[model samples]
Target chain A: MNSQQIHLASRPTGMPSQANFKTVDVTLPALQEGEVLVKNTWMSVDPYMRGRMIVSDSYIPPFQIDEVLEGGAIGEVIESMNAQFPVGAKVSNISGWRTTFISDGSDLTLLPAVGLPDQHFLGVIGMPGLTGWVGLFKVAQLKPTDTVFVSAASGAVGSVVCQIAKLHGCKVIGSVGSDEKADMVKAMGVDAVINYKKVDDLTQALRDAAPEGIDVYFENVGGAHLEAALNVMNPYGRIPVCGMIADYNAETPQPGPSNLLLINTKKLTLQGYIVMDYWDQYGEFVEQMGQWLKEGKVTSEETVYHGLDQAVDAFIGLFEGKNKGKMLVKI
Target chain B: MNSQQIHLASRPTGMPSQANFKTVDVTLPALQEGEVLVKNTWMSVDPYMRGRMIVSDSYIPPFQIDEVLEGGAIGEVIESMNAQFPVGAKVSNISGWRTTFISDGSDLTLLPAVGLPDQHFLGVIGMPGLTGWVGLFKVAQLKPTDTVFVSAASGAVGSVVCQIAKLHGCKVIGSVGSDEKADMVKAMGVDAVINYKKVDDLTQALRDAAPEGIDVYFENVGGAHLEAALNVMNPYGRIPVCGMIADYNAETPQPGPSNLLLINTKKLTLQGYIVMDYWDQYGEFVEQMGQWLKEGKVTSEETVYHGLDQAVDAFIGLFEGKNKGKMLVKI
Candidate 1:
């Protein structure tokens, strides 16, 4: 069988473009014993993928030229030699940016039909959802009385963080790049939403919103957002750094927060984390997050593209803040 | 009775000079009920005091002009009306920079003679000791297999950190300002010492010393030292920020590490703490540290100034790296 896949054509120097990706057709071999064939339906595009595109050392390996780009995906089992994965069963896998793939079943996770859309397995009820849960509750050690400021609060991981903080009885302040994203996150129970693009002075805006001072800062966008958070943070404030989307494509290394010394003067803790570290608690998170979803206490939002060919565009759009929540490509 | 005291005559802009302090003789007031008179024997001078000299909000209140500067001190109670404190009892209090003081006995802590010199209470067994203990074990969550790096390794707190990490069977790398300080820290059993003054590239020097990368960074100095630590830190590294003495006297904000994005890529935790936060564990710490001293497992080093008149110079000398270990003035 033939399948359409996207490959890295070249390394990106700054903002990645369609020129960095090449779509190709590859023939799939017949499934051997214990192998399962998956027809991918939903593929994820995230900010961390930007790091993988660069030719440098990172937690994950860089995507090589003329090779299939990989990520989170939800697929249907079209054929299976393994008894555990029956034909027509739905599953989640990490062989994304492709229309169909043959896997040994080791990297695939069984996905039960939970009544929500299958794409939710690629978003709010999946890795992005877990990222928010662990970073806010465990890493930041969120308190019920904490006033939290979330940058890029309209994005995938950040939207879930906003809703979770609100549910914990925290005063939640969200910063989004547009009025549209501000309205979306506000609907998710964010107490105050700052349209960062509309603000002349972000620090002044944050000070006005959090008059008492922020106790926890969920850092998604770096650069100016980090500096603003440092300015308005209270003594002993905690910052759980999940991503730095603002500097992901910068041509040169960006200077850190000018007021970084405040981390000492204010006795703050700034910790960075990846969700893979908490994978052992994934089942526990799913139970609680699943309940919240059923109770309508949390909502999942996504911006979906129609075909595998649009995967590269979906990824590049993330840097431009083109998606409200999770950005996905349906194959 | 008349006693001599040093007061902050004015706030300093950059490096403080002798003009910033004023020496005055003040007459003691008549002791009231519950009041006790203390004759200070030794007073401590620390780098953090530089921040208190500036008129700004901090963990502690700013010192007012013409007021006696406060810090750790050991004294003998020459006269006491309170039954809990005997006339000849030794006490430790935060009423320093003066030869004698009158107290209500509320802020004073009774000191039992531990067989060590009285000045040891103002140093190795006091705040600086507790600072290293809590920063290494509590904040950094250090483990036996960890490789630790300490900046200002010859300073009061950094010396203790080096010894503690060595006792825990961890490899220790220390950065010192001069060959003399380097030899002093090396005598404390530091595995490797980087004489930063002699190095052209501090990061390369650290890389050579800790080829496997450092797991815990005892941050006593900021600026170049912090930048170097950031470069050679292993994944999941912890930085317990004790002090930033290098930037204590900067006239303008100093630029932070440009490669701070490594915090995210390496999943690092940088935590800032003050000893006051760990006061509850003081008794537990003193018990262990006392045992270590008796067994000759740990040692205290001091560079003493002869008179209370040298208090301001002792403090300013800290910025110039004038002391090898604890800098104290014997009144």
Candidate 2:
């Protein structure tokens, strides 16, 4: 069988371009005795992928030049020798940016037989979903009375944070790049939405939006968003830093918040976390999130590219804020 | 009876001068029933006092202009009508920058008779001591295997933190301004001492000091110190921010660490804390610290300025790094 794969052609200096990635056609290897063949149906392109494109040590290894890129992907076992993952079983794995691959079944997880669509498994109930859950409930320790502020409010993890904070009876303020994004976040029950692109001063806008000051800041965009949040954060505020999409493409390290002294004066706690560390609680997360989806308490949104050729575009589009929510590539 | 008090003449814009304070003589009021008269022997001049000089809401109320300034002080009760505090009882209170005062005995704490000097209660065995203990054990959750980095390692709190981490079997790296200060910190069993003033690149100096990377960064100075620490911090590192003495005197807000994004990449936790919030644990701290002092496991250092006239100088000297350890005024 033939498979299409996206390989890292070169490391990007600043904002990644199409030249940084290349699509290649390759013949798939026959599945070994304990292995299964997965035909990837949907692949996710997250902002965090930018971190892997750089030549540095991080939570995950950097993408190697001239090698296939990896990320969250939903697949179906079309041919399998492993009893644990029989033929026709739907699965999720980190073998994304590819149309098909043979896996040893250890890295693949059988998708639960939920009523949600297959694409939802690559978004709302997937890695992004777990990120929002852990960052809010575990890292930030969200309180019912908390006034939560979410940056990148229309993005996958951020949208989840906004809705989750609202469902927990907390007041939420969201920051988005455009009017459309603002409207989308506002529809998710965000008490105030800051169209950051239209604002002259983000700090002033955040201060006006969160008059009582934010108790929890779900940090997705760093740079100005972090600076603005620091300005209006209440004493003892908590910041769960999930990603800094703003600085992801910067050639040079950006200057941090000037008001960082507020961290001390305000007694703030800023914690950084990666989702994989909390995978032990994935079962518990699926149970609750699955229930939320079934009851219409939570919903999923996607901006999907159709082929492997557009996968690179979908990933680069994340930095440009072209996607409404989860950016995915459908094979 | 007469008392000499140090009053705030005006709010300082940048680094404070003697002109910002005024020493005035006043007749002591007659002590009412249940009140006690205290003659302050030693008063502490802390870097955190600079925060109070600014007219802003903080953990503690801003020092009011044209009013008596307040801070940590050690005093002996010369006269008492309150049964809880008798004459000759040594006490500690926030009635400093003054020679004498009449209190209702509400804010005073009776000093433990551990055979240490009366001024030791103003430094190592006082609030600064408690700050080091709480920041290390409570906030940073220090481990014996941890490689600890302490900024301003010759200052009151930093010195104690260095000693405590050393006693706990942790490899300690210390940053100090002068060779003398570096030697002082080195004498406290710091594994590596970096004279930050001598280093052209603080980040490189820190990296060279702790090639293994620091697990716990005891932040006393911000600005370059914070930036350097971020560069050298290991994955899952913890920062317990006690003070930012370097930025305390800046008229304009300083830019934070340019590498603040490392907080996310390294899964670091930076927590800001005030010593007052952990006062409930003061008894436990005193018991442990008192034992350390008695057994010679701990020692105190002071840079004393005699008389209330020199109180303002002592306070101003803190920003200039004039004090070897605790800056104190003996009245």
Top lDDT hit: 1
In angstroms, how far off is A310's CA in candidate 2? 0.8
The segments of candidate 2 whose C-alpha lies over 4 angstroms from its true place after superposition are: none
lDDT of 2 by residue, B1-331 (tens): 8988989999998989988888888899899999999999989999999999887768889999989999999999999999999999999999998889999999999998778888888888889999999999999999999999999888989889999899888999999899999888877778999998898999998888889999999999888889989888999999998988878888887777778778999999999999999999989988998899999898787788998888888888888888887888989
The candidate 2 chain B region of ten consecutive residues with least summed lDDT is B252-261
TM-score (chain B only), all candidates: 0.99, 0.98
Cα RMSD over interface residues, candidate 2: 1.0
lDDT of 1 by residue, A121-220 (tens): 8889899999999998999999999999999999999899999999999999999999999999989988899999999999999999999999999989
How many backbone clashes does every candidate have? 0, 0
- What fraction of the real A-B contacts shows up in model 2? 0.82
Q: Please, what are the lDDT tens digits per residue for candidate 1 over residues B99-166?
A: 99899998999885568778878777899999999999999988999999999999999988999899
TM-score of 2: 0.98
